[model samples]
Every structure is written in structure tokens, then in C-alpha cells.
Target: MLRPRKFKELETKLGHRFKDPGLLERALTHASVRGGKIARFDNERLEFIGDRVLGLAIAEILNQQYPEASEGELARRYNRLVRGEACAKVARNIGLGAHLILSESEADSGGRDKTTILADAAEALLGAVFIDVGFEKARAVVRKLWQEQSEPVPEVAVDAKSALQEWAQGQGLALPKYTVVSRKGPDHAPRFTAEVIIAGRAPAQGEGASKRIAEQAAATALLTREGEGGRLGDA
Candidate 1:
């Protein structure tokens, strides 16, 4: 059983105390915990619901914030923002891991510090908050958590194809082209591998379920590698 004093401190940090208190208890409980009155429900269901809710909230925020941006660009930024790493970073910032009710094995295996676990827990926490309060309150909670990470529109183009094209144009290089390197698997579900080639550099390769997606992946890989290695401007 969690000590009353500890529960009080947790509630203080959470900014809202549960009326039933069991709800909050279940929110922190992991499936691994055994033989406890509060261990009946795990956090997985809440995590699932919270994932969608978080996506919707963030999507709405991105849509309003970047009206001129293409959907692909918005999607990339949205992906980065809601990714597990980002969620775990937010979880750590709020000291959420210390409040989890994990199994002994999980506790010893560094589960408390695991990014995936923390991210899932953060989503579950959001769901608990939404169920306890309301959508507006849940939005407020997420906004508070993400306020520091939110930024003004980034100057870097988020779409790989757009960025690659702009880079090529700026360097006075011939426009890059994508070619299918190979195809594999059944015709109905063929996997395509494509390469993006620029005028004077080694080509970058990517694989995807379709030719168009493969091309985009190739562009993404090439842009990422070039951007990081400082070869993009010279190409």
C-alpha cells in the first residue's frame, strides 16, 4: 500500500487530487504488480486512449499554428513532437517516474528510466486526467507540459523532398531524381527500394512499401545524411 504522505506529495505534483483516489492509484499501477487491491486495472487501456487524444490535441495545435505549411511538413513536425523520446523527456521533466507502481523486476531493470515505458506512462497519465476532468482540462494539462518544448515555426523545411529540392536549387546543382533500385516480394505487396542521386555525390538508398514512399524515404535519408555531414551544400 502507498503511504498517505507519499500519495499526498504525488497529488501535489500532479496538480489535481483524485476524488476516488483509486483512479490515480490505477493510473500508476503496472501490470507486473501483483496481489494488491489497487492492481486490478493496468495502465494499458488508458495509454491507448491517451495516445489518440494526444495526437488529436497536437494535430490541432500544429494546424492552427502553421496554416501555410503543407500537410507533409506538418506531419513530420507532429511526428517529432509526439514521438516516444519527446514524451519521455516531458515525463522526466515532471518527475513522473518516481510515482510509478512497477513490479520489483521492472524497478530493478531500470524500467523507471526506460524512455518507452515513461512515454507510455505519460500518455496514460493524460488519459487519467481527461477522464477525471474533461477534454478542456486535459488540453490545458498537455499545454502546460509542452509549453517549453513548443517553438516558433522552424526555418528548416520539414518535408524531405522539399528540403532536398531547395538545397539542390540553392547550390545550382541539377535537380535531384529518384530511381527504383530494385523491387522484391509478391506483386500484390511489393517492396520498392529507391535511390536519390544528385549531380556529384554518391547516391542514398531507401526502401518502402511503394515506389513513391521509397522515393520520399530516399530523399529523407539523403537529406538527413547530407545535412548532418555538411555535404549537402557542396552537392
Candidate 2:
């Protein structure tokens, strides 16, 4: 059967023709679009399964690709690859934003471009594919999409927060302070917004599912700005 125009385009981008396009459609449907209560119809259930599917696929790849790496190293690399930012980046690369089905309010509020939503949708897609096909095909898709980031594992994968602290200490600056700017979403999946303030530097803001992730994002943002130029940091 011919698919809808949007799903056709999405399938092309994903490089996987779906036998059941309904799976893809449901995966792209956000909770906000479905009144936040359609447990069986929304993407949240798919997202939950997809998270596991993604984790397993990544683990298999990491194990095979870097046989010499230790468990700790593999764990770090896996964390980086499976993080919300990583998923969001893949979603953007595949132009998944344009295919999302969000409520009018969500669309008006820029839900299509939100990191969390995009990431969740990406995971849901993976889950849908896993269910539609088999593990091997899902593995192939993961391998293709995540190839760029599948380089050899580093000896030490210092998190952004740790790296930022080390940089600050190296510059003889006081330790950066992180404040929770806002918290939203359901209890199961709360979104936290954090702002990090460095002495003599302007604050940078980031959002994530937890306080730790938000702080790390904020620190990473600050570090990225500093690396780009002296102005963004100063501002």
C-alpha cells in the first residue's frame, strides 16, 4: 500500500520501507497531540521500548567495533551515544522535525524543534522499526545512522560537567554554580532547566530530563561558547 506523503518522505530519509506505516505514524505522534492520555495510541509506549532497543543495538555495536575497550570505556561511550542530545541530533539529520504530529499548542510553542521531543520521537521510531522488522534490520539502521559517532572508544570519557570544572580550575576561576531555572513535565519524565553561572562569565542555560543532565548541558553550552569566541562567554 502507498504511504502518506509525510511518512513516505520519512521512510526515504530513514532508508527503511515500512511494511506497516501505521507504526511509523504512531511513532511520530506526540502525547500533546493525543491529549496526553492515550497510552495505547501515543508514542510514549513505543519510546519506552525503543529506548531499550536502541541501548541493545548500541551495546552490540560497541562490543563488536571496539573489542579491546574495557567495560568502563564501553559504558561511557554508550552513554554519550544514547543521550537525548545524540538522539536529537540524529532526528535533525533525518529531518524528523517536519514529520512530527503535534498539537496546535505544541506546534505554536515550538515542540517540533524541542530536543526532548525530537529525541523521544527518534527513539520511538527505532522501537517501531524494531517491532516491524527484526533485530538485525534495526541493528543495521542503528549502525548506518550512528556511524559517524562510532569512532574508537577513548581511554577516558570525561563528562562535560567534569571537563568544565577542570577548565575552570585550570584558569584559577571559582567553581561554576548551577541553578534550576524551571522544572516541567510528568513525574515519570520531568524536564529540568538549569542555568550555570561562572564568576566573571555570563550564564548559559540548558534543559534535560534530570538536574544532573541539565547541569551538564549548561556547562557544555558555556564551554562551547567560550571555545567559539570570547564574546559569547562574556555576554
Candidate 3:
């Protein structure tokens, strides 16, 4: 069946055509919208299914891509890949934000560009794709979208701080700078707050007993923010 010109354009970007056009529309519709044959929840259920759907797809992709990597290594990469930031990055790449249907308040508040909304909408789109076809097609869409992020781990698996430094250097940036923001609490237990700064980005802060721990925590926060799973790996 023929669809509106906009959906056809989106399908071209998704690299898949939907057998039921309504599924594609539902995937793009946000929960905030209510009325006229559209419920406030259609996309949410799709988002739920998409979350699991994405996990399985990413796991399979990792399994095939990193045969030599340890389970821990693969898990870290999986966490990074399945994280909201990563999904939001993909949504942004496809210009998915522009296609979203949102309530006036939500749209005015920049729901389209908001990371959480974009991530959920992205997964919902995957769910729509899964339903329209099957797991094989869903995996194909994921592989096509996540190709670059699925590359081999760049730095040797190490502590969060070391990993963050290597990540920054890999991106051709200066080493991360750690600063002590405050020291509080009693002599029996002193609390330290440290902030780590990567050039051109805002600082991420973490708190711990000692300056070293605080620095490491800060590094982990930054790496997590950058969606590398911080490489902490059960630390």
C-alpha cells in the first residue's frame, strides 16, 4: 500500500518497509499524544518490546564480532551499546527526532531532542520493525545502524580512570583533568568530591572516601556519560 511521502522517506532511511503502515506511525507516536484512534500507550508497549529486542540483537552482534573477547569484555560493550545514550545517538543519526508525534507541551519542551525520549522512540521503532518482519530483519536493521559502535574495543580493558584516559586520547583529546571539589564529614570518615574534566565538555563529579577513589569515580562517571559503560565491569 502507498504511504505518505514523509513515511516513505523514513522507510528509506530505516532500510526496511513495513507491511502495516500503522505500525510505523505508532512507533513514531509519543505517549503524550491522546485522541482520535491513537492511545497514549501504543508506543510505550512497543518501547518495552524494543528494549528486549535490542538487547538480543546487540548480544548476537557482539558474539559474532568479538569471538576472542572475554565474557566480561563483551558484557561491557553490550552495556555501552544498549544504553540510552547509544540509542539516542542512533536516533539522532537517522533524524528520528523529527518524525516523533508528541503533545504540544512535550514538543514545545524539546521532547524530540531529549535523550530519554529519543532513546525510547528509537527502541520503539526497532520494535515496529521486529513486528513488521521478524528477528532476522530486526538484527539486520540494528547491525546496519550500529556498525561503527560495534567495532572492536579500542583500549585494553583496564580500570575506569585508565580507560577514560585512553578513550580521550583515542579521540585525539588531552588527558582528563581531575579536581577536588570538596572535603567533608568527620575525621573517622572523610568524604571527598572530585570532578573530572575532558576538554570541551562539562565535568562529571564523584564522591568517595579518598581523593584517589573520588578521581576514579569521576572518571567512571565521565566514561558512562560518554556511553562506554565506563569499563568499570563489576568494580
State every prediction's TM-score relative to the real structure: 0.63, 0.69, 0.68
Candidate 3 or 1, higher lDDT = 3
Relative to the true structure, candidate 3 reaches a TM of 0.68
TM-score pick, better of 2 and 3: 2
Q: Kindly indicate the candidate among 2 and 3 with the higher lDDT.
A: 3
Candidate 2 lDDT by residue in tens digits, 140-233? 7888887787766445556776567656766788988999999999999999999999898899999999999999889889988889323223
Candidate 1 accuracy as TM-score: 0.63
CA lDDT of each prediction against the hidden true structure: 0.77, 0.85, 0.86
User: Against the correct fold, how does model 2 do in TM-score?
Assistant: 0.69
Superposed model 2: Cα runs more than 4 Å off: 153-157, 160-235
Minimum summed lDDT over a 10-residue window in model 1 is located at 226-235
For each candidate in turn, give its C-alpha RMSD to the true structure in angstroms. 11.2, 10.2, 11.1
Worst lDDT 10-window in candidate 2: 226-235
